[model samples]
Target: MGGEGENMTEDAKDPVTYEFRDGAAWITLADAEHGNALNEVGAAALWRAIQRARADRAPVVVLSAEGRFFSVGGDLASFAAADDVSAYIDDLADALHRIVSELMRLDAVVISVVRGTAAGAGFPLAAAADLVLAARSARFTLGYTKVGLTVDGGTSLLSATLGLHHALHLALLNPVLSAEEAHRAGLVAQVHDDDELDAAVDRVVAQLVTGSHAAQVTVKRLLRGAATPAPETALRREALAIREAAARPDGQEGVRAFLEKRTPVFPGDR
Candidate 1:
């Protein structure tokens, strides 16, 4: 279990303040004094880390913050200091959205371990995870409207996953929901005692690691395909994805192993 904690200096003022570790890549919003506000550098770091996690075939990844709140969305202080608000906002949104979208497309499972408050972009980032295990003390809110701005970072997509009416209420009302409520509303997968969250996450990750990588990737692609376009179109993607999986050497080995009642020898195994 490598430590998912790193401190890197970027330029002179804006430093890269997150870390990736073990088979589980992670990004922690460490600027707690500023509410773990999302900034351009942090967003880019997270995006790159996600890419790394995919290339390395990490079993599971977790996103958390080291503070009372997960993140207060974007860093208002940096935005106000920027000379070009429009460009900054666009760049920030693009990076953040890319991270979330990539997480969705990746084969490895992602989990959000929300300890306390996860508001604005934080909420959607959590929602984007394949699984969200929120601490009993965690609370979530789409706090964009309260700050006089529209949503970003797949907030709309995350909201839509919970159905239209509930999403609309979240966007319009911006009221916070307890972790248990979030689970009941389908926003989060489970809620654990704050002290037991790390163990719960570890168990989930272990379960994911025990499965066949080929099957996991195939199913993930199928699910994503089913979510997009009409059933006919989704079925086409599913067929294509399954066909590709079947053609792989590992898939062939798996079938043969099942027939022979032996363990499958996956590709690249010695």
Candidate 2:
């Protein structure tokens, strides 16, 4: 673990708090007073935090929020207040899209810890993570239509992951899924009791930190590649990545530890 403090920003009112510790970067949505709704400043600050995590070479990145609801999605009040709603949304979407792109391409394993309701863009943001862990009380819904908006933050990716039929049901109806239902629907990977959520996340982070960073990163890349439409290209990339991983010190150490029947201490772990 590392020191705990709010991320420094010129604007003290920024709604995101970022911290890097051990081999993980923790990004918390700090605007709980407003249900963590993202306004222009919050969106930009979130992107900056993601960029910082990428640059820091963290092996794992945890995305969580400070309030009961993970996020209510885009700040509707901000949008309403904007003189030109169209332009406001356009810029907000651009910033959020950049953050989504970074998360998709990042080598670090991304995890979303959801405790309460994740709606609209928030739902897609959680879906974008490599893995999602939700408290038993967590709820999720694609709430765009309810607000007279379409979707953003890579909702299409969620549709692809969930398959068209289920995706349509979620998008068109905006029905909330409980944590168990989300897991059944393939949206969340694990569900923990509300009281156990923090420990569960910590356990996962500890496990990831002990593994070979190079191999884990390569695996993430390979999985992303496999998810794309280009199978042949994805296979080729996977082959190259595996070979590259095998040449790295952590990979070599992993193999050696397995052969010796000893616990592996990856470079990042040290």
Candidate 3:
């Protein structure tokens, strides 16, 4: 991350930017204008970026974002605009699941740097990493329920990371957590002052890059092995549930209400 990055993706406007800098692979969420919303295209771009990092066998892989938000999760406007929202979301979830799976299976130390907001898919992506570093101003949330979608992007893994009731809190209430709050909940490994984040991450990355790569990968695999539901199974279930939910009346109402900036009168409200 410290070096002047050489472009890996041909177009600078891709959803993600991948580069080998220093001794690590840096993959940044580059679609900042729309809060780095994940859609099929972005998810595919992210998967390719992760694959590049995996292929490089980088000892340290850094996942970060540009602008204010890490990622706001799926693109609701895009879904609402699609002729078949269910199919669109299904494809999106499939793509995102692959990214999450690849990131977890990568034989490197993955670190997510959270500067602002990391909600919905962002939450699980960061949580899946070996370590998560956050700026003091960082925030986290899981607002899928607020939009009447079940959830996807490996969010089911939150239970293993945050415990059952805490995961439920995120899924049901959609409460936003400050970086300090997330740290207390064990999602964040380290928190730094807003401007000090890079330096802090740099130190950790330097340490990781010089450390034993096999030992690091072994540790990650061991811990992941202990996680319940097998992330793959959970991801598939989430994708199915989300696709079904997206086709439901509640989900449609939620998306319409969101784009219209109004309260959703879901089917249950009748």
lDDT of each: 0.68, 0.76, 0.88
* 4-70 per-residue lDDT for model 2 (tens digits): 4436454545688788876689998988898988778888778878888877778899999987999
Residue 37, candidate 3: alpha-carbon lDDT: 93
**Residue-wise C-alpha lDDT for candidate 1, range 86-120, written one tens digit per residue:** 45665676667667767777777777789888887
C-alpha lDDT of residue 161 in model 3: 89
The number of clashing residue pairs in model 1 is: 0
Question: What TM-score do all the candidates reach, one by one?
Answer: 0.76, 0.80, 0.96
Query: Where is model 3 poorest over a 10-residue stretch in terms of lDDT?
Result: 1-10
* Of 2 and 3, the candidate ranking higher by lDDT: 3
Candidate 3, superposed: residue stretches over 4 Å from native: 1-4
Candidate with the greatest TM-score versus the true structure: 3
Candidate 2, superposed: residue stretches over 4 Å from native: 1-6, 9-13, 229-270
Clashing pairs in 2: none
Report the candidate with higher TM-score, 1 versus 2.
Answer: 2
Instruction: State how far residue 76 of model 3 sits from its true place (Å).
Output: 0.4
- Scored by lDDT, model 3 comes in at 0.88
The numbered model that scores best in lDDT is: 3
Can you write out model 3's per-residue Cα lDDT over 1-270, one digit (the tens) per residue? 223476776787898999887799999999999899988888888888887877777888999999999998888989998999999998889888888888788899899999899988888877778899999999999899888999788888888989999999989999999999999999899999999999999999999988999999998999888875388899999999999999998999999998999998899535
